[model samples]
Target: MAFSAAESKLVSIFCQSVLYGVYVVLFTATTYTLLWGNKARRSVRRHNMLFVSFLIFVIATMHMATNFSRIVLAFIIHADAPGGPAAFFNELSNFTQMFGSTLYVFQTLLGDALVLYRSYLVWERKLWIVAFPCLLLLGSTATGIGILYAFDKVVPLADVFVVQLGHWITAFFSMTFTTNVICTSLVAYRIWTLNHRRKHGDSMRRHALRPALLLIVESGACYSATLLALLILYNVDSWFQYVVLDSVSPIVGIVFSVIMLRIASGVSTEEGETALLGESGVVNSGGGGVQLSVLDADPDQKTVAV
Candidate 1:
């Protein structure tokens, strides 16, 4: 059975609303924890995470609001049109739709950049390590902008499956997905390697690093998996892609907040605190000297102490 455009959009908005509700709950809990929870306060990364969380949430909220207004415009304002809501929805160049696309692209860029930044941090700020991913990020940015530009020049009632637009959209999705996968893998590998090399009396630190790696991979999977699904569905011209697309903004927030929440919770544990201190490697002897723990296998390798 062929799913009408209007039906697809309705389903998309419905799913988005449900997911946005969940996002709101998670965002609230995350913000509260970051602001007042004792566990979250001790994390060195708290402020940066909190700020990004708030920004993602605000963008998501605006996305949700834009979609809501789109529903109103399509169903009520255009009720008397020839084909009703379906016809209205077919107009790919609608202002609200364009704005929604802009929001999605912006959120996606932010999410990818966050992953890149974390990867850089985990890899000890090695520029060479992130060079390829940086190029991919640039590709994503360029292709994303190209998509919005194509949206403006497209016909009022045109669909997204057109040749030029489809190509740009596909490129954008592919680059962003690649960027995320690469960055996530790099961070996870670095942490795993460090965990494997820890010596005796480092069980606490091992425990801490293990969960950080796990949380990172798990959270990254959420976004990357959804994006892959969207990419495939879009290529297949499935109307169901609308549902996935609409839900992505909130998913972004969910993933971002969940990671911070888990990290904060983990850091609150005794093992995690000991691990953090160990990683910090501050010693107070008679001379008051400082000690730095080496994480890399090669002693001569210039690497930041994890």
Candidate 2:
């Protein structure tokens, strides 16, 4: 079935709206965890995470708002204009559309950078480990900007599957996909290696690391899968790409916040209070990185201090 641009836009808006609502609830819970959920003392790391959370939430909000505006312009404001909503949405150069695209670019790059940083942290701050992923991120940023510029210069009302924009967009998508896969793999490997090294420990301690690794892999997979779908649909010139594209921002925010809340949940005290406390000073507490806190293991307790 060949779906029209307007149909894609309608589906995109609907999916994005639902995702945005979910993101709002997750963001609220994440905010509470970072702010007051910690029964123990708060550190600069928590504050930093809170700040980044707020920033990402704001960006997602703006993306959603711009999308809503675009919807209005396409469906209601210009319903009877020529080709109707399809033609209106095809105007990628329009300011509102451009702005939303820009936000998606920014949100994606920010998430990639955070993943790279997390990789660096989990690898014990080994600068050499993240060196290549950094380069990939640079490539992603360049191609991302390139695509945006190309969008403005492309023939008015032309779809994004055209030659001028295709190359840049493909490069952007591929680079981002590669960057995320590499960084996420690195983080997951590091966690596994650390756990493997502690194989002689008690079962509780041995199983503690699994949750962290699982959380990282599961969360990373969500974003990677989305990107892969986008890359495939884009190359095939499917109108369904718009649905994936519009949902990207909220998905990014949701994934990021989910990690925060999950980790906080893991390290929560036994009294059913959620907290993220590091036994040895501050661990990998950077914003958006897997905040790994090594709590002192107790022989009698089956606590998850990953």
Candidate 3:
């Protein structure tokens, strides 16, 4: 069946509504991050997390706001009305619509950078292990910048350039997904390897690796799955691709904030610590750092540095 313009617009609106539902979670998560960061004591990691989370909060909000503006501009103005959807969007000169794309790209870059940084830390600060992801990040950033340049320079772009835009988007999403996968896998594997040395509260399960592993997988999977969907659909030439594109920024924001919130709350991991079970409220075997009473270490066993 042929796709009608009204049908397309309806799908786009539906996607935006779904994103708004997700945004509720985004706002909540961000508020929790802010509150938690405010209460956290001064430390290198604490200060860094606060700064990064705050920066992401600002960028994610901008991205969501831009999306809302474009959605209103696209849907509220009737196509038959003066300066309808076509005309408004046709003017690539109209900065608002395209601005969302840039904001989304910026947010994606920041998220990728954060994950890579965590990976670097988890791997005993071994820069070589994360070097590949870092390189991909740089390339992804350059590609994203190219897209921005394309939007600005090719206002009222030719029909032939649509495929060019698609290619750029595909590259961007693919790089991000790869980066996420590598970072998440490295972190999870490192934790899994350390699971054998587990020590925790039998009553509360406060120091178990299973829960920490689950949280990391679940949270990272939620974000990765969305991007993977978008990446797969990018080449399919479907209306749903447009819909997924519409919801991209909000979904990323929600996932990013949710992870931060969990960290801040000390639910999955502690602020300013490595993403390990010990970081998830375990009794630190190393007496030099935090000492939680919830779980006790075996006197006969050696303290393994995770």
Clashes of 2: 0
Across 72-110, the per-residue lDDT of candidate 1 in tens digits comes to 999999989987987777676789988999999999999
User: What lDDT, from 0 to 1, does candidate 2 have?
Assistant: 0.76
Q: How high is the CA lDDT of each candidate model? A: 0.74, 0.76, 0.61
C-alpha RMSD for every candidate: 7.3, 5.9, 5.3
- Which residue segments of model 1 deviate by more than 4 Å? 196-219, 268-306
As a TM-score, model 1 comes out at 0.79
Give the Å shift of residue 83 in candidate 2.
Answer: 1.4
Considering every candidate listed, which one attains the maximal TM-score? 2
Each candidate structure's TM-score, on Cα atoms with residue i matched to residue i, is 0.79, 0.83, 0.74
Q: Rank the candidate models, highest lDDT first.
A: 2, 1, 3
Q: Across residues 75-107, which tens digit of lDDT does each residue of candidate 2 receive?
A: 999999998988888887999978988999999
Model 3 residue runs over 4 Å out of place are 1-39, 81-93, 155-161, 196-219, 268-288, 291-306
Candidate 1 residue 5 Cα shift, in angstroms, is: 1.8
lDDT tens string, model 3, 1-306?
844333554676567667756766666665655555543442345656667666765666676566567667666864566656645554554688568777778888887887787677657788999999999999899899877776676637332137547677678889999998888777766644533344333521545655465546533656667778878866665545656666766666666666656555443343223333333234432334543222223334344332
Residue 283 miss distance in model 2 (angstroms): 16
